[model samples]
Target: MDITVAEALVRCLEQEKVEIVFGYPGGAILPVYDALNHTSIRHILVRHEQGAAHAADGYARVTGKVGVCMATSGPGATNLVTGIANAYMDSIPMIIITGQVATSQVGTDAFQEVDITGITLPITKHNFLVKDPAKLPVIVKKAFLIAATGRPGPVLIDLPKDIAQARIKFKYPKTVELTGYKPTYRGHPSMVQQAAGLIMSSERPVIYAGGGVRISNAAPELLQLAETISAPVTHTLMGLGCFPGNHPLFLGMLGLHGTRYANQAVTECDCLIAVGARFDDRVVTKVSGFAPSAKIIHIDIDPAEIGKNVRINLPIVGDVKNVLGAILPLLKKKENGAWVARVQQLKKDYALRYDRGGMLKPQYVLEKLNEFKDDDAIVVTDVGQHQMWAALYMRFKEPRSFLSSGGLGAMGFCLPAAVGAKLGAPHRTVIVVIGDGGIQMTMQELGTAAEQKLPLKIFVLNNQRLGMVRQLQEFYCEKRYFGVDFQFNLDFTALGRLYGMEGYTVETEEQLLEILPRVLTSPEGVIVNCIVDPEENVYPMVLNGSPINEAID
Candidate 1:
C-alpha cells in the first residue's frame, strides 16, 4: 500500500516487532516524529539526543533486540556520537535515525544540517543516507537485521526532510542481501567435534562467558553444556546477568577487578571453553601468562574476534547458543571432581570482601539497593566505582535483569538507560545507580524521564569527584587529583528540579532509609542524591600488568 517514507520507516520497524524507540524531536526531524504518533511503536522522548542514544543502547543490551534512536541534524546528531561509539565498542545492536536538510539544501550547510552518515561511518556496522522515499522500507529492514545479527553494532540512517515527507509504496523484504554482512550460524563440523573431544578428554574445564552470551541469548544452552559436564563458569563484567550470580557453578566476575579465585581458576584450567567471550586484555593480564597450559576453544558470532586477542586451538564461527547446542550432546559427562573441588577451594580462599567504614560506601549503597529490588526489577548503571560495586553486590537471578556499558565503560550511561529500561519493562521498577561524575555527564536524561512521566528511581552517588580516575591516580599517578576532583560542585538536586523531577539529598544512612522509600512510593520520577566520601575507591582492583594477588586493597 502507498505510504509516506516516515510511515514506511515505522512500518518496517513494527514489522520487525520493535516495541519501543528512544529519541528527541527537532525541526528537521518533525516529519518522522509526526508520523510516530500514527504508529503503535512506543517512543521514549529523552532529555537529550545523547540520552536517547544511550537509552536505545541499554534497551538493546537487555532485550537482545535492535534498539532504535532518533534525532535531528547537526548538534542533535553530533550529541549521539558518544552513545553510538559506546555501542560500537560494546558491539550493541542499534539503529540510529537522524534528520538531515532537504535534498536541495544538502552540502550547503543549511541550518541544523550535518553529514551524520559520514560522521558515524567508522563507528557503525554500516550507514545509509536515504535520499529516495522508496528505499525507506528496505533500508530500515536492512538496518535492523545488520544491527542485531552477527557482531552486533550501531547503524545510522540519515533521512532528508523532503524524503521523510515523500510518498512511497511500503514493502518490507523477507531477506536482506549484503555481500559484507554474511554471518555464520553453524560451526564447522570438524571444529565442533574437536572442541567436544577436547572437553571430554580434559582433566579440568572452565567456560568463560561474556556479553555476547547475553546478546545471543545463549545462557540456557551454555548452562546446559556446563551442567552436562559439570564444568565451572567464569564471567566477564558484561556477562554478569547471563548466568545466575548465585549459582554454584558460577565463579563470579573475572577481569581487572575480578575475584582472585575467578582469575586463578581460569589460569589453572586444563581446558578453556571460551563461549561468546573474547579474551580481552583486562581479563587476561599477561597474554603469554594467561591459561598457558590450557587448550582454548573459542566460540563466537564474529570470526575475527576468535583469534583477535588470544590464539584459539579450536575455533567455532557461529552464534554461541547454536554452537553450544550442537556440542552439548556430544560432550562426555566426565566426573572431574578434583578440578571442581580445587575451584571451590580457591573460591573459599579468596572470596570477595569489602571493609565496612564510617562513611557511606558505594558498596553499601549497592547492597542496600539490592534489598529493595524485586527479582524482576531492572537495574542500569554507568561506568566507574558504582558499576563495579553493583556488579559485585547485586545478585542477578535472571538474564537481562542488569544493563550497563560493560564493553565501552561509558561514564554517563545510567540516567537515560534507566528511561529505556523503564520503557522496555514498563511494569518492573527501573533503577539507575550512577556516580556523581557520571550523573552530571548526561544529566539531561532527567528531563526525558519527566517528560515521559517515567517512574524511575535514580540514585546518584555524590562523591564530588571522578572516583575511578581518582583511584587510577592513586595507584598510577601517585594520588595526583588533577582534573579528577569536582571542586565546583553541581547541585544535583537543583539539576533534577530543572528537569522537573522530584529531587532529595541523603547524607546519612537514616536519611537514605527514610527518603528512598518515600521516593519509590511516589508515582512521578525521583532522584535521590546520596552524598558519599569523595576519597572512596573500589578496592581489590588488579593493577595493570599485575597478577590477581597484586590487587589494590
Candidate 2:
C-alpha cells in the first residue's frame, strides 16, 4: 500500500517503539506535523528549540534509549546546536529529525533554509539529508543504529518538505548492513587476564570508573571487581550514582574540587584500573603528576581514547561489562585489611564538614536538602557553584538519578533537563538545583513546565552574581569583578508566578527549615528562590598548573 512520506516516517518511528517526541513546528515542516496528529506518538510542544534538544538528551541519559527530537529548517535547526553538541560531548544517544527546504532549493538560499546537516556534521555521529521518500525508513534505521552503537552520540535526519508530501510504498528495514561500522564488544582474553593479574598483585590499588560504567550497566561488575580486590573506587562527574555514594569502598569524586583523600589515594596507589573513563583535564590537572606511581590499566570501548590524554600501561578495547566479566573469574578475593584501614583513615581526616558561617550559606542549604530528600529522588543541576555544592553534599545511590551537563558544563541546562527527566520518569521526584545567573539563560522553559503541569521542585540558588566567575576573579584577577554582579535584582519568585507556578524565597535558615520541606513535598509545580551568600565558593580546588593532589581548601 502506498503512503505519504510523512506517514512512512511516523510509522517507522512507531516500529522503533518511540512513544514521545519533543519538538516545535514551523512553516516548512507543516506536512510532517499534520501526519503527526494522526499518529498516537505523543508530541511535547516546547517553548524553544534548545529546550527540546536538552529535554531529549536528558530522557536518553535516563532511559538508555535513543531520544527523539524534531525542528524546522534554518534558525529552528540552528537553535538545537547547543543541545546536540551537549549530547555528543557526553556520548548520549539521540535522533534529531529536522524539516528542510525542498530538495531543489538546497543551495538557493530560500526563505528559512539552511544546510542543517552540514552545520551539525562536526558534532553528530552521522547525519542524512533525504530527498527520496522511499529511502526514509532506511535512513532513520541507519541513523538510530549509528546513534546507539559503539561510542554513542546524536544523529540527524533532515527531511525536505516536498519529500514529506511525496507518496511511496514503505517497508521498514529488518536490519542494516554497513561494512564500515562495527562495535567491539568482546574484549581480548589475554588483556583481561593481564588486568586481573595487576589487580590481584598490587598492594594498594584504586578503581577509577566513569560514565561508561553506567552506560553499559556495569555497576554490579564494577562493585564485584572493587570488593574482590578490597580496593577503593573514585568517580568522575558523569560517573556519579554508578556506585553507591555511601558505600564503604567509595572514595567520593576525583580531580579538581574532588575529595582531598580521593586524590591522595590515586597519587599513592601502586595500581590504577581506569574503567570506561577518559582522564579529562578536570580530573587530571597536571598529567605528569596524576597517578604517577600506578601502572594504569585502561578499559573502554573506544580505542581512540586509549592514549589520547594519559599514557596507558595496559589497554583493553571492549565493552566495560564484557571486559569486567572476563576479568572477574581470574581475580582473587583479597583480605587487605591494612589497605582498607588506610582508606578509612584518609576519609575520616578529609570528610566534608562545614561550620555555620553566613546566615544563608549554600552548603548549609544543600546539606539540609540532602537530609530532606529520599534516596530515589532525582537531582539535576546547572553549571555553577551550586552544581559543585550539590555534588559535594547530595548522596546518590542509583544510576541515572543525578543528571547534569558533565562534559559540556552548559549553564542553563537544569530547568529543561528536569522537564525531560520528570516526563521520562514520572514516578520519581525531580528537583532542579540552579543558580540565579544560569536561570535567566533559559528561564523561558518555566512556561513549558507550568503548561505541562509538571511537579518540578526548582531550587534557585540566588547569589545575584555569576558565583564561579566571581570566585575566579577573586583568586586570579586581583578581585576586579566585572560583568558578574546583578544589581537590578530581578524577582525570581514573582517571575515564576507569571508562568503559573507557585513561588517562594527563603533568605534565612529559619525560613529554609520552615519553607523548604513544603516546597520539596509540594504536589504542584513550584520554584523556590534561595537567597544565598554571594561570597561563597566551592572548596578543595586545585590552583592552576598544580597536581591533582595539591589543592587549596
lDDT for residue 406 in candidate 2, whole number 0-100: 86
Candidate 1 RMSD to the correct structure: 2.2
| TM-score, candidate number 2 | 0.98
Which residue segments of model 1 deviate by more than 4 Å? 490-524, 547-549
- Note the Cα lDDT for every prediction shown: 0.84, 0.89
Which pairs of residues collide in candidate 1?
none
Cα lDDT of model 1 overall?
0.84
Residue 279 lDDT (model 1): 85
lDDT of 2 by residue, 44-95 (tens): 8889999999989888888888889999999889999999999988899999
- For residue 19, model 2's alpha carbon misses the true position, in angstroms, by 0.9
**Candidate 1: residue 386 lDDT (0-100):** 85
